[model samples]
Target: MKFLFKTDYEDDIRLFPHSGYLWTYGTLLVLIAAAPFVLSSYLISQLVFVSIYAIVGVALLILTGFTGQASLGHAAFLAIGAYTTAYLQQFGVPFPVYFLTAGLLTGIIGAIVGFPALRLHGIYLVIATISFALIVEEILARWESVTHGNEGLRVKTIQMLGTTVPRDSAGFYYLCMGVLIVVILGAINLLRSPTGRAFVAIRDSETAAKSMGINVSLYKVKSFAISAAITGLAGCLFAHKLTFISPEMFTLQLSIEFIMVILIGGAFSLHGAVLGAIFIVMVDPFLTFLKDDIPGAIANFSMLMGAGAERAAAIEKSTAAVASANGLKGAIYGFLIMAFILFEPLGLYGRWLKIKLFFQLFPLYKRATFKRQKIYVKSERNR
Candidate 1:
């Protein structure tokens, strides 16, 4: 049983509140540092992608989870960053300058979108974001001169200060990991600051927050800008990672996947972003494997139905259905979102908390210790 007894106010707010956390984080860092040497090239590449998604996930968490704003158009910000980097790189701009430029430009766009839509909440805001995403996708497709339309754009190797990092190189992977670490630390610090508190305050109760003199509208716009900036940085890295990108890549499905990361992992917690990224990245291979195995399973089942022309025709239809099911990735995401929302609102992080508490309490743990409670009230105002 571990106890984190706070000695002072500083201890309560410290990033790592206990000595156990220090050792655990230190060990995790050491393992990450050694991963390039110990892991296969494929695994290393996957981790690179995980790092990129983790950055985006954290950005969404800040906006949706902390600020209580919803955006179904985050892919638009990503598309902006990617295209910005691709366009600027072609003009001989260095990686750092173009990268930061992408974030800045995307942040400005986010603020523009947020200014008018921030006043709207719930489904109205979601619809607005969805419209924004569709508009951006159309722009990307129609702007053939700049974005090359559906032909897509090829990205060159990223060049830092006198150093070039190729997409497949270990240096590129380390660069991504380094950026992820920095973003995680920065997010943690931001969440502990006054600005982060204001975000949470707005999320909890905008009316109460306004009563306390918090500028609700300004902070909402700021939240959008900051979230877009972070996601845009991830997009810059994503472009370099893939070495090629098309407008089709930043679809509504991609935005949904971003939301899934925080939803399944735990929206209100920073670790949830990383956990969700890992789950999303790792699950892709499993899904692919299932896609492959399903056809064989279906064929075997068809054989068991006995040999006949009618059976053969039915088997063929089943085979086609199974093959088409590969495109059900969006359906899978929707199912996962629904399941998490209904059964585990706090997400995987919440489950982790419960397990940790169980272990801490040991034999004294009660079955109802972590059970959720429901409260209902009848209102005369409704009548």
Candidate 2:
């Protein structure tokens, strides 16, 4: 009898209010589209990274978030796609054909790797995928003639229909935005389909899903292929945009970053991916600045270092730049993962949806209970 008060079927069915979703997404889309006009060049550049992460986050959402498959080798797929772009350019292949070939090739590799998932789960599966990523890195670093060893390869300027796209920040931002919109819409449509249902079912319970006549193995591999294909496309864009490639760029860190994007974003939610990407990318620089300012501002730091003010300033700047380039991002990423798990498991989008729904259903509600929950524990509690 106590359990009845704790659970509500009607509430479960009404978890995502229709009006709220519409208003929230509609407003978000408008803001994203208008960002270029109001944002700084640096911000636009950051937004380009956000867009790239959005695409990768969506891919991670499909495999790990939607299908509940743990993967730590996503960077390998990105590497495959990037290397393919470089390889095709070397052979003078057209961009369109090259991208298609890269996606297909990466998908094939993803499917093959996913085969092991048929018998593995949890940490075992994660280890296998991570091993696969390490192996890919080893190959990229060792294959001298093809991969150019540690020297890395330079990417050419993007040419579409004989016109070279501008290599500046604004052009790249717009290009990334276009790709992001298309990918997001495509992801939403896919998740609304039968295949998407199968993936979700498998995520919930592979045994039950298999019992219901879904081929678990086939769907798992198929989901991985789709996820990898999307990541591959993002990689192609990333490689072309940077006009450079190296094995170091597609390391295990890259894979961890993709995972962080989705985890920080709500799992199994499309908007969460975009929201997570935006928040994470924007916060990265701020964290780096904080790291630099703290050390420089400390009184003990000035006393301990006999170095002159000029040297100190230079050291501070260099350290700040290094933090900005790498260390700060990882620390913040880890912090975000932990924080989201503790406070907002559904991520920023989930919180936004809650606010939208609350306003839409305000004044009439008798109980203090929210129509849509944004808090971390709400998912399990709602269930």
Candidate 3:
């Protein structure tokens, strides 16, 4: 219901459109600052996961959401960041230098991939990214000298300045939260710049963007590089958070989860990335709890269905089979993605906007106020 009337050009482009936004954001910042002391260690760890995913989610949003370019292999960039951090630490590289280096290396690799992928579109681009992910995984597994292969690599203690922050400590949590805030602010600023507008123009219509004199190819590569750099920076934090990582941890499924975060939360908006990260992190424990209880629940149901010894044995076997279906998490993610695409394409953020608008308009709001509209151009049909 809040409204802001712009009186000058500065008001139109200001980061905080009104006093309400300023106060709201300030309150959120205060809450984040106090979270470490108020929340338990387990909850803080979960928040760290949220922070890590939020960073990566913002990166994906830039490329896939803002630029209309799909990358199914972003997890590879994360792995590159993690491994780079790990290897650099062995040579006694300072934390800041190694962390920045990870991002730089991954950005270079992403631009390299983007260069060859400029000719592809839609599913073809997706396939190329997926192939890139697979190739990276294979290389990580085979290159034992550097990556340590399937045996995995343990991260050394994280040292910044003269202080060492343990993974389980609140200092580490603050580090992650601080980095996430910086990245979010940077993204907000970037999207307000001319470069960000060009990316959006390419996404909406490449031909039109080209007609406007935008360097579509160069912008696409730049988007990839920037996205990869942010994602890679996130991976550096992720490596320290877990203190151990292997090729398996950066699988295609992980990449899909990153995509799912943005898709479910809302792709076009930066807030969507944060919301998606929170949803994913909060839902994870519930899924784990369900995984633990499902077999017992199935067994109980089977017992209720029959009472014979043979029936009991059959029920036990069925329970075991059902219990072993850890793939249920992946299935849930896939289902959510399909549901969002078909029924609620704009995602959680879009739904929230509708609700807010409906309340703001109250009695004047029509049922069709938020309905989707189709725009059909006769010229395109004729062609």
lDDT of 1 by residue, 122-211 (tens): 778999999999999999999999999999999999878788888877899888988889988988899889899999999998889999
C-alpha lDDT values of all predictions:
0.88, 0.80, 0.90
Give per-model CA RMSD. Answer: 3.6, 7.3, 3.5
| Candidate 1 TM-score to native | 0.89
Candidate 3, 187: how far from true, in Å? 0.6
The Cα RMSD in angstroms, rounded to one decimal, for candidate 2 relative to the true structure is 7.3
User: In model 2, which regions exceed 4 Å deviation?
Assistant: 1-34, 291-327, 361-383
Using TM-score as the yardstick, the better of models 2 and 3 is 3
Model 3, 301-356: lDDT tens digits are 77787667577767767766654577867777888889988888788898898888
Indicate whether candidate 2 or candidate 3 has the larger lDDT.
3
Clashing pairs in 1: none
In candidate 1, which residue ranges exceed 4 Å CA deviation? Answer: 292-324, 367-369, 372-383
Query: What ordering of candidates by lDDT runs from best to worst?
Result: 3, 1, 2
- CA lDDT of 352 in candidate 1? 94
User: Where does candidate 2 clash, by residue pair?
Assistant: none
The runs of at least 3 residues in candidate 3 whose Cα sits more than 4 Å from the true structure, single-residue gaps closed, are: 291-324, 374-383
The candidate, 1 or 2, that scores higher on lDDT is 1
**Predicted candidate 3, C-alpha RMSD:** 3.5
RMSD of model 1 against the true structure: 3.6
| Model 3 / residue 140 / CA error / Å | 0.7
